[model samples]
Target: MIWTLFLALFFLETESSLTQSAAIVPQDPTLTIGSSIRVTCSVKPELNLKAENLYWTLNGRRVPSKFYTVLNSTALNLTLNNLNGSKQQSGDNLLCHSTDGRILAGTCLYVGLPPGKPVDIICWSRNTKDLTCKWTPGSEGETFLRTKYTLKYKLRWYGRDKECQEDHTADPYSCYIPKDLALFTPYEIWVEVSNRLGTASSDIITLDILDVVTTDPPSDVHLSRVGELEDQLIVRWSSPPALKDFLFQAKYQIRYRVEDSTEWKVVDDVGNQTSCRLAGLKPGTVYFVQVRCNPVGIYGSKKAGIWSDWSNPTAASTPRSVSERIAGVCDPKSGEQNSTFRRELKQFFGWVKKHAYGCSGLSIKLYDQWRVWLQKSHKTRNQVLQGDKS
Candidate 1:
């Protein structure tokens, strides 16, 4: 009976010892470039065990303690900094053995390079005004190693290896291009990724900057006359290009001189649009007219193109009757009223006759006469209205 009891006790002790032995299980069975990894060894429960003599081997070569950490008599964590964990590292065995010289546990880590070749890179503008670049991210399977990526951009304007910018991000995909660069320039960009194992660069991508050109001008421009006394001509024009996004507010100027005068007068200080009238012309005298347009760009900067060639000058004369007074109502007030009424009647008759056949083929002399009289009548009425109000 005693022998039987002793034998049973001995067997139980041996079984317990075997069960308490340590075993190494790598957290990640597969390793990749640039990834940080941990390997652990679990030891069976044993009283008074100390973390001493834990050993790790990477690919048949002993990994120095500087590269790995041994914890609590069991766990071994290896951080292969900057070292790409690849096929060679994967085939190597990581061992955790006891100080007692018993092999507790072992596991082979398989490291691999990330699959897939670098893909094409593409670039675009952010606001149709600035450029941007982007690319696809690298991918690994479920057991993939963690990775960091960088994007490098170079401008062709700067020459080879000269203008390079680096961008670092956790994701492998996408980057923004710099904004507000000069229009009509070219740029080149590339991307790269690095893991513990190694680094790979993507193909270079090139892009060009282009201005959003305005193919058409604002549209048909027309002129109309306005104003009261002083024989002022009020020229008014309509807005061009109805499309809200495309439409640009513009500044206007009138270039005019007395008939037979060679020098041009510019009235450009006025900002944006298509109209201005000439004032203080002699009654019955003809004046020539021309118009120029100035468009405002971003930042309110003026962009002036060639001035439109002189429009066929529409001639206008101040009303002569307004200038010459008659007897009917001789009081200064009565004289002014009678003169204004006659001048207006004459101007109206002239305009009717001139435009009766429409604007086409109207003689320069007739048109000029009609315009002068029209301006004179309009100015006189405004002066009278102003005096009455005052």
Candidate 2:
């Protein structure tokens, strides 16, 4: 009786293996959405099942016999109509079964839409060091899958196409190109996207490396009063980190606004220096001042690089309005030793000019020009006073 039971179990197991051996057609196919596709199930000739004995199931639901046809006793075929992205992306599973409802064989169907072309690709470089580009996903942004994006770039005249390394920026659609970039040679850039369905590429954009140069903002900004002059504020800042090697000349701009006002008054003649004296500010009023830099003549090119971001605002108030304190110190009240008084006043102004650059006095250059003009004015003033007495 035990031998009989063992043989019976063996026979059942063999029968189950045979039932599951039917070959499902197309074996995990990938196809486009809205397109029609065929699937088939077949078995060995000796084990061929009659059409009435065979059936199919999709995602655990019975497939209607009306959608299938029997080609022979050994083969049955099913046709899917208007395949959708959901079916493709999820890899819908199909199974062949006996009429009694046991699974014979199975296959997963892949149906999804290909990624659409990327759009609006644009790029910029930071202080001529690295290039960064970003784009918008194309084709309704629905690939029904986790699509991958890549940035590809190359020089117009040299080098092979290269892929940018993602430094893990917050923007997934952006890519950074680092190191050994050409400043004069134009670069072509684009984005490529791909997934199981298909791949698409964005339009190519070309740009000069210098044209997109932006750098870290000027740092260590400071503001202070200019001597006793209540209408002047001196602004100073250091160069950006990327430009600190003294490899290029940088032009600077200074702008200021009153604490209670939004209007900014920009100084256009700060030139390439790192310091500027701002005059004509309202005495005793708080002013907000900022500085920006643009590198010029780097790499021996005449083009001026793009401006860096504005430095953080530095606040300072012009000194309260005061009468001329130096007038008493440098002036001879009764014109005694008039020649000696003139020399003393000149000496006093010279000392003030030396410290003026760091303070609110006119810039050193302006101070020199000022002293020359003052000498002419002082000589004329004394002559006129002496003539009036006579």
Q: Which is the leading candidate under TM-score?
A: 2
RMSD of 1: 21.4
Clashes of each: 31, 2
Best by lDDT: 2
Query: How much does candidate 1 score in TM-score?
Result: 0.29
- Work out how many backbone clashes candidate 2 has: 2
Q: Candidate 1, residue 341: CA error in Å?
A: 66
Q: Model 2, stretches more than 4 Å misplaced?
A: 1-20, 43-66, 70-75, 87-90, 95-104, 145-150, 165-172, 192-201, 221-238, 244-390
Question: TM-scores of all models?
Answer: 0.29, 0.52
Give the whole-model CA lDDT for all candidates, comma-separated. Answer: 0.53, 0.76
lDDT of 1 by residue, 209-261 (tens): 43221222334434333322334555554433432243255555567676778
Clashing pairs in 2: 88-111, 226-360
